[model samples]
Target: MEPSSATVAAYSPCGSTAAVCRAVAEGTGLAWDERDLARGTRPEPVDPGTLVVLGAPVAGGAVPALGLERLGRVHTAFSPCVLVCAYGDRDPGHGLHDLEAIAPGLGLVPVAAVLAPVRHVMVPALGAGRPTADDLAAYRSFGAAVASALRDAGGLFDLAPPPLPPASCPRERLELGFTAECDPAACVGCGACAGACPAGCIPADEPYLTDTARCDGCMACIGVCPVRARSLSDPARLAAVRERCVAGWEGPHRPRLVMGA
Candidate 1:
């Protein structure tokens, strides 16, 4: 990669991935171009020597579907890239593999992949205010090492995704087919939930309507609703998951850097 022309292509559902992207950019000690996938921007094919940093949270045991779809539209030819997957304290399901799967098609060469543990938005009780000081330190330290290696090797960080833990995620979580509903009686019609729906499943005109067919069940509405009126259908069952997953997280999980041969 041309040391000065690196770029970060990112899709951050709750900002953890975005933070990780920026940390890596800082480590490169160069100016970086950023592309936000939510806006439907397809990144242009990068130059042969350009370095790319890819980032997103692990969702539904994979990279966010929409983000991956948009990224796939960008076709490049052997552009070096680093995959960064941020997840709520638990292991990052299939995120690294997801990025690796897309890299070849997108003209990105797999040079390295990093996993950064972040706060869980679903259950704030677990890993709150995470990607903490220690986490950032680890990320930057790894980033600097990768950058140095890339420079030393004349624009090559070619590395395979590390051997990650078995996904072992819940079947329900894997589907992500759940829909969120708003209790109009409890809703103040403040439009917070509607505006917060990432998939645009909520209608602004009605303010209380959620198109179940369009909802991807990201649960963003549940967190942003000030009135606390939005909820998934099976709250009782999912709550059990939150408790158990959080209790078992066993933190002090740091960021990782995997380099290729």
Candidate 2:
């Protein structure tokens, strides 16, 4: 079928990546749909004319495995796509390479890649602080650049070379250790935590509980919960969780280019 309008879909862990995707779509005046791959399913087949953009956050220098899996399923159906990796100040080598490896396998072409700044709430072992006005501006500027690129392929910003090998596929899984204790009394059984979880780790149905195995520790659930019942046990882990959860991030400097088949 012929592509109708540009469609931008993303698997955001926190909300920043989705925000960026929305910015690009809004700036470019294209149709946009966001799926919390953590909680939702991948989209169906789309036309070749449709511009498909997939975005994810970088966890420990790599894309979340679940996000990768969803992308893989839809990659083949969507070609000439835009790959965006959201991260803090750290380099985007692993994130870029991971997407590159998955692109061809999914029948999707990488058109461009970009690495942009995100606000990190959890103070890293080294860097810690709220994003400055300049930081926010930078993200918006990056969004504008992405918008330009979407409008005209050549208009995208060129990112610095990734730190890792172009094709190296590293397995840096997201570790969600216990940060604090959850107060069952505070949990009103609303299932908001389960619904908001990015990895679908938390089961919203009966026996509603968090499945740490699948949790990326984005804490979107905890943040969105109306009762504020969920809490972490480990302070360090909690900090890391907060960092991953609240860190508003951006994609690479440039969009990855997908070679035409």
Candidate 2 wrongly placed segments (more than 4 Å): 1-4, 75-78, 90-93, 121-181, 205-208, 236-261
- The local distance difference test score of each candidate is 0.72, 0.54
In terms of TM-score, how similar is model 1 to the real structure? 0.84
Error of 1 at 240 (Å): 1.9
TM-scores of the candidates are 0.84, 0.68
> What stretches of model 1 exceed 4 Å from their correct place?
41-48, 155-173, 188-192
Q: Model 2, 111-198: lDDT tens per residue?
A: 5554544543233432233133444454445444544554554422232222423532345654545432357767778777766665
| Model 2 weakest 10-residue run by lDDT | 252-261
Q: Candidate 1 lDDT, tens digit per residue, 180-228?
A: 8888899888887776666777887787788988777667788778888
